[model samples]
Structure formats: C-alpha cells, structure tokens
Target: MAIDITVDHAVATLTDGTQLRTPFWRIDSDRDGHHLAMLAAQHGNEVQGIEVARRFADLCAEQLVAGTVTLVPYANLLAIRHRRHSSDLGPEQPGRESQGFNMQQAWPGDPDGNDIERVVYALDAKVIAHSDRLVDMHCWNHFWAAAVLARSDNGVAVQMAEATDLPFVMWRNSPAPEADIATSSHLMYSRGGVSMAIELSGQYQMREAEVDRGLRAMANVAKVLDMIPGEPEIIDGPMLEPLAGNDVVVEAPCSGIFMQSGLEPGQRVVQGLKLGHIVRDDDLETVVVRSPACGRLWKYGRHDMKCDVRLPDQHPYASEGDMLALIVQACGPERE
Candidate 1:
C-alpha cells in the first residue's frame, strides 16, 4: 500500500517561530474504517508518549501499514521547549514561569486567548477537528511512577486500552465536578471525540526502555484501530482504579529528611505502621511517620520537608497537616 504523508502547521506561532505541526500519514487499506490520532508531550516532561508516537511513525513508515494515522509529537512545544513535563500541577522553573495553564487542561481552546489556551485553540482547529479518537500521554511529578486513565465504556477508549494492554486502567467511575472544564482529556470527550490519557514510568530523566515500551504499545494500538498491520504483544500489570474523586493529602505529622526504610508505592500497610521517619537536623531525635489508616500505599510525595516548613516550599522540616504519603485499601490482587 502506498502511504500518503503531510505536515500541516497551525495558525499559532511561538516567539521562536516554532509552529505546531501535525503529521498525517496513512496507507489506503480496503478495511480502513476508524480515523486515529496519537498525541504526545501535551505536558512536556511526559516524554514517553512522544517517544511512542515517534516509534509508531517509524513503524508505519516501514512495516505495518494501513488506515489514516495522525501523529502529533510534542503537542506542547512551548512546554517541551522549557523542558517541563506539566504546566499545571507543580512550581514553575525560574525563567519559564509564564508557561502555566496545563496544556492538557486547555481544550476547544480560545484563539484570541492566553498563550496556553491559544495554542490549544490552534491544536483544536488543526488536528482534533479531523480525528475520531486520540491518546494523550502524561506522567507524574519527579518522584512518582505511571498509570493509564480512560473514560470507561467509551468504545474507542476501551478499544484503545485493550489494544495497548498497558500497566493500569484508571476508569473514571465518577466524574469530577469540574470534569467539564478541568483538563483537555475531559474537554476532548465532551467535544464528541474519544480520548484517553496514558501515563508512563520515570520522570525528568528519560529512559529508553520506557520509551520503547510506550512506542510498542501505541503501535499495537494502531493495529487495533486497523491503522497498521500485525498484532503487537499485550503487556500486563496495570493498576486499575475507580477514578479517585479526592486528592487525599498525606501530610507530614512532623518534619524530617523522610527516611523511608525501603518503603515503596503499592505496598500494603496497617494503621500505626511506621512507614518512615523524619530526622532532626542537629542530631536530634527522629519522629516516625506512621500510617493513618489500614490501607495500601498507593502514592507518596517525591520530596521530604522539615517539620518547620510549609508545603510546596520544600523547607527541610514539617508542620502539622503536611502531606506525607497516600494509602489506598486493596481490592484484590495487584494489577499485573
């Protein structure tokens, strides 16, 4: 099959002339049905999804070939340009402070709007307007791992997850009150296009293995969409969660250099279990950080704070109500 390729540029232009480019490539196949697009680096730091799109492009350009495939590698160039993964959640870097408004959050964007929203408007016009389904990739802050989130039962999203067979499936069991305007993923769904957010492992420091895994999975997803030929192997081990409605803050009871005695995410714990300890700077006594409930450790903060400092400031000590760790009750076997 002969594949046709095109690079369409958006109306928005950065100060550096870095226009948003959408690469549309496809080979005409008799069975071609669904139109598919995979977007990566909506948040610049989540590099694996972008890597996946790169590999999918290469594979389509070489081996498995069919259907229409639009790959938007590094959708948020400004964020990627600044080398920050997410623009919404964390503190901005010293020089790139203006890159707020999480790119993923801005959807069906405002053309004559703020920088981030303007970019979204351009993307909505240039790319999203032409696609039936999308896969938006994301990652956690520096210290956390990865997971996959999808609007459950949405046909395209369900098929996409089954195709990739990723590590976890975060089903939106209950929608957030602001689900309508919270992020681009939700906005995309509201606009009649099916979309899913895939989170990959590691952060800040990119790893080739994770990239390869993400790419391979995405390529497999394309095959599921009939955009490519040949079935790709499915990977297991995904932490499936019934969409969390709350951002439970596990704060530091007292502050210290959080000495987690080999504590890791996904580990089960009981109430009063000493998960870690906060050490005093001047060779003083250490305070043990214990679990508040009998549950499993699902997530934790990457940085430790002292007892004296306020949250997000990273003061080495802690005060009351400071976040420490997040624990969740286990359902059955761990997703694997």
Candidate 2:
C-alpha cells in the first residue's frame, strides 16, 4: 500500500510582521536515508531553480514513495508576486527597478528586517531545521551561460557534482576582489549542510536542454545520496577555481562599440590572447582587447550592445565589458 503523507503549510510571521509561508510535504517510508530539501527562486531573475523544484514536487506526487523530500519551490513570493526583485523595491527604484533585494544574500535573515530579510530568515528556519541535504538552484547572468558552484574541495558536494555531469564546477567562492559573496553558493555550505548551487542556464525562457539537464541532475543527486537506488552516469569536465582575489575586470578604457571574436562560453584562452576589439566608431578604428591571464573563458558579453562594458543589473546585449567572458585556471577531476 502507498504510504500516506502529511503536508504542512502556513505563514511564518517574521519579527517585522512580514509573513512568509513554509509549504512542505513529509512522506513516511520504509527506506532508510537522510532528509533532502530543494529550494529555488530566491532571486526573481534566476527562475530555473524554481522550475526544477516544481517538477520534482510533481514527480514525487507520482513516484516518490521513499523517504522525505521537502521543497520550497518559490521562497521569495513577494518578489515573485510583484514581479519586482524585492518586496520593498518598486519598478522605479532608479536603475535597479522595482525588483526587491536579492533574497539569497539575506541569509540568516533578521527577525526585524527588510521585507526580503524577514522572508529569508523565516524560510531558512523551516528548511534548515529539517533537511540533511540541500540543493539551491540558480541561473547565470543573462549575458553568461550556465555553471555549477560548490564549496572548495567538499566531498558531499562532490558526489552531487559527479552526478550532474555538468561542463564546469566553480570551486571556492569568487576570489575576485570585486566578487560578491551575498548571492554565493557558500551560504548553504556555511550552514554545515551538503549543498551545491546550480546554474540551470538563461533567465527568461524555458530551454528544453536546460530543463532536461536540471531534471537529470536532480535524479542523479537522488542516486548519489542513495535516496534512490541506482548508478548514475559520471560527468567528465574541467574543475575550475573561481577567479582569484587579484583577478582583473577588463573595463571599457574608452566608450565604443563592441565586436566579438566568436569566443563561446567555456572556451580557452592564454595570457595576452586577443579576446575581441572595440571600435570608437562604426569606422575601422578597431582597438584590440586582450586577455590578461592564461585560463579558459568563463563569462562574456551577450549579442546585443556595442559597448563591452555594461552597467550592473543591465539588460544583456553585446557590450564591451559586460564580462565579455570569464576565464578560469582550468584544473583536473576532483578527488572522490
């Protein structure tokens, strides 16, 4: 007989009286294993993570008769409901628009806090209290493609890394001096949980390839954790360190039009290599942009604007330096 499950859903009032709901399902099974919880959509722009959680919930309703899998498909509902980045933010909040604060950064949120902070803390309590394993999914900047993130040299995360078989896994937090840790994968790791941040690819559209990869990654995670019994295919790819604290951000020395050299995501590069060129005018005064280091291309400008340098939170277009690309010092397979 199928086991009966009990679900609990209610609004958790933060210290500020801003309430957030914790909707979870609990299944009692004969299987012996750890509790796993999947969370997504902490950021409004990174939507794929939320999609995966929704799909997994559906799959569980149909076939997950095993132990428990708690899901918070959309943790930042205020941002989602208003279609703003943060609940306190409005559409006209200067260049930032109405999107609220990035919820992921508001970890261990305050009881008396900003709308985003209160929400994050309330939900964090529920998920952290029950889960032994956690997976927080995200997507890349509209300009860059997808990639996975984990704490440097962690074994539990390694198992999930092997299962996904993704093309790259960024080790350690960003060493780049300008790197922002607020939205990093390290938050979950800091809490002493086995967690990995997944970048599913793209922000807006539901690309089938990305969707398939995410679903496969979820299944692989289950198998790796022994939540489900099976052998998952191992993925072979480059393991890279996020840029060092001394990493350079190639900015626009002079405003001009950006032209790409057809360098794709996850490509290779050498120090002094010609990355692309910028033109002061539509005329042929092309100024060459070269790589400052020896590594693989990690992130780059998209295919829309002319200037390579783009403002933070700006729309993706072929610009001069909107991270025209990220190049990492490539390394070998991680130890199992």
Candidate 3:
C-alpha cells in the first residue's frame, strides 16, 4: 500500500538580507533510517536539476516510505532570478572575481562576508548539518549536452551514485589543483556524511532527456539511502571513467567567428578528426579545429550564430581563450 506524504516549505535569511525558501516532503513511516538533501541550480543557468528535483518531490510524496527528503531546487535564488550565473550582490558587494564570485567557490562563507557567503552559511547551518547524504545537481557550461558524470570520494556518495543506477559512475578525484573541501558537498563529506555531484549536460537551457536521466538517478539515490521503498531502477548504460582527469578544457587558439563541424558530446572521435573551425570575418578564411586525442566527446560549447535556436535557447558566442569544450578521457579507472 502507498503512504501519505506531506509537503512543507521553509524560509531563510542571508547576511546580505536575502530571504530564500525551500520545500521539504515528509513521509511518516517506520523506515526512518536516513535523511537526503538535494540542491539544484547552484549555477543559475542550470535548470535541468531543478526539474529533476521537482519530479522527485512530486513522485516521492508517496514513494518515500522511510526517511525525510529535503529539496532546494534553486540554491542561488538571486542568480536564477536575474538569469545570471553569479548572485545579484550589485555594485556594493563586488566580488573578488571580475564578473563576481561564483557561489560554488565561496563556501564556508563568512557571516559578515558577501551576499553569496551569507546564503552559503544559511544553507550550511540549516541544510548540510541535518542531512545524512547530499546529492547536488549541476550542469556544465553552455556546451554540448554531454554524458553524465557522478563524482564523489566518500563511500556513501559512491553508494548513492550506484543506487541512482547510472550506467557508469565516473569517479573523478583529480579536479583542478584548486578544487577543495569548501563547496557545500565538501562540507557534507567533511562532516562524516556522503555527498555527490551530478553533472547533467550543458547549462542555460533545459533539455528533456537530461531532466529524465536526472530524475531516474535521484530515484535510485533515495532507494540507496533506504528513504524510499522499491528496488532502484537504474537503467543500464555505459559509465565514463576518467583516465587523467574529468575536465580537459580546450581553449580557442584565436578569436574569430566560430563555426562548428556538427560535433557533439557523446560522439566518439579518433585522433586528428576536425572538430570545429574559426573564420576571420574580414578575410573569409577558416581555420580547422581538430581533436588532439581519441576519445568520446564529453562536452563542446556552442556558438550563438551556430547553435540551433530550435532548442529554446542557444548559447552566446565564444570569445578568444574561452572554454571551447571539455573532454573526459575514457580510459582505465579506480585511482585516488
């Protein structure tokens, strides 16, 4: 028999005087063994995660038989509201970075710090401390809607990823040298809990396939936590294990009108294949973009003049030295 679940919403105030609200769905049953916290849209442009969180909130009302589930669909409220990646701290709170401080990097934030910091503090005090496991939904930059990557160091995180029954769990320990234990997931992991980050395709626009995959992964995560009833229905698939590291950023060699070769993430390519081109608008000369190695396409940024607007929203034009694409070397795995 199904159970009766109730939904509730809570609000919090940031030091910068930003008030944020979140929704929690509670299922009162004897199976209360774990607590799961999900954060979506840490980057405002990423919306597929929110859709996944919403679908889980709707289905888990009855599916969650044991523990409680807390879902914060929009972690950066001001960013999402303004349709920007960083928070709307305005001129007064100018961040360290030229554009602004990314919410993901300003973790363990100062109470008297900037707007994002206060918000992070609120989430840490209210959400991270109370959860047994955390699943953070995020999207890569405006690139090819690529394959999914599940990242974690803790066993519980790995278990949660397995429960999501994703085909292949790409465990990346080699983040950029700058990666550390300051982000929200890192906070949860440091406190002896498990946290996982799910990167589901490109940002700035919503993709239906990406949203469905995310929903399925979360459903499995709940099952792994024993917060929800039923066997995890992880669809069979191929998992991409990182060889060197997860992110292999390719930068544009020169500034020009970018043109693509119809290359996409998830497309397998051999070495020397032409990936894209840059045309000098003045001379009408085109340069060839080629693959340096043989691997699957993990991500590729699209251009405004190139990307198909038929998909609702196309990304902006690429600038010189911008992140052109990210390639996850598909090779051997299991290394610290």
* lDDT of every predicted structure (CA atoms): 0.62, 0.61, 0.66
Candidates sorted by TM-score, best first: 3, 2, 1
lDDT of 1 by residue, 1-336 (tens): 444455666667543555544343333343456556677777776666766776676676665444566778768776677676444334434222334467765677786666677788887777777777777776554334355677676777777776665544567643665655646666666667777777776545567766776786777677777766767576544343423632244687654566776765545566677877877555667877777665455565435422111235444355556666766644345321
Q: Please list the residue runs of candidate 2 whose C-alpha ends up more than 4 Å from where it truly belongs after superposition.
A: 1-7, 14-30, 60-66, 90-102, 110-114, 173-192, 235-281, 284-297, 302-323, 327-336
For model 2, residues 1-336, the per-residue Cα lDDT tens digits are 444555666355765565567666555455667677777666555667666776666655555545677777677787667654455554434214434366776676666766666666667676655667877877664455456776656788777876776656766543454544454244455556677778766654566666667777777787788766677755535445455543345554444666667775545667787877777544547687787776556666534331212343443333444455566654332221
Stronger candidate by lDDT (2 vs 3)? 3
Candidate 3: how large is its RMSD? 6.4
Expressed as tens digits, the lDDT of each residue in 1-336 for candidate 3 is: 565656655455666576666455544455657778888987776777888887888777767777777787877776788665666534322223324357777676666776677667677666667887888888764455433344555566667777654423566562454567667766775667777788777677888877887888888888877777778884543455545465466677766656778876656656677888877555667777777766666666544332321242243245668666556554433111
What is the lDDT, from 0 to 100, of the residue 260 in candidate 2? 69
Q: Quick one: how many clashes does candidate 2 have? A: 26
| Candidate 3: residue pairs that collide | 168-239
lDDT of 2 at 252: 45
Tell me each candidate's TM-score: 0.67, 0.67, 0.69
Q: Could you give the C-alpha RMSD of every candidate to the true structure, in order shown? A: 5.8, 6.5, 6.4
Q: What is the lDDT of residue 206 in candidate 3?
A: 86
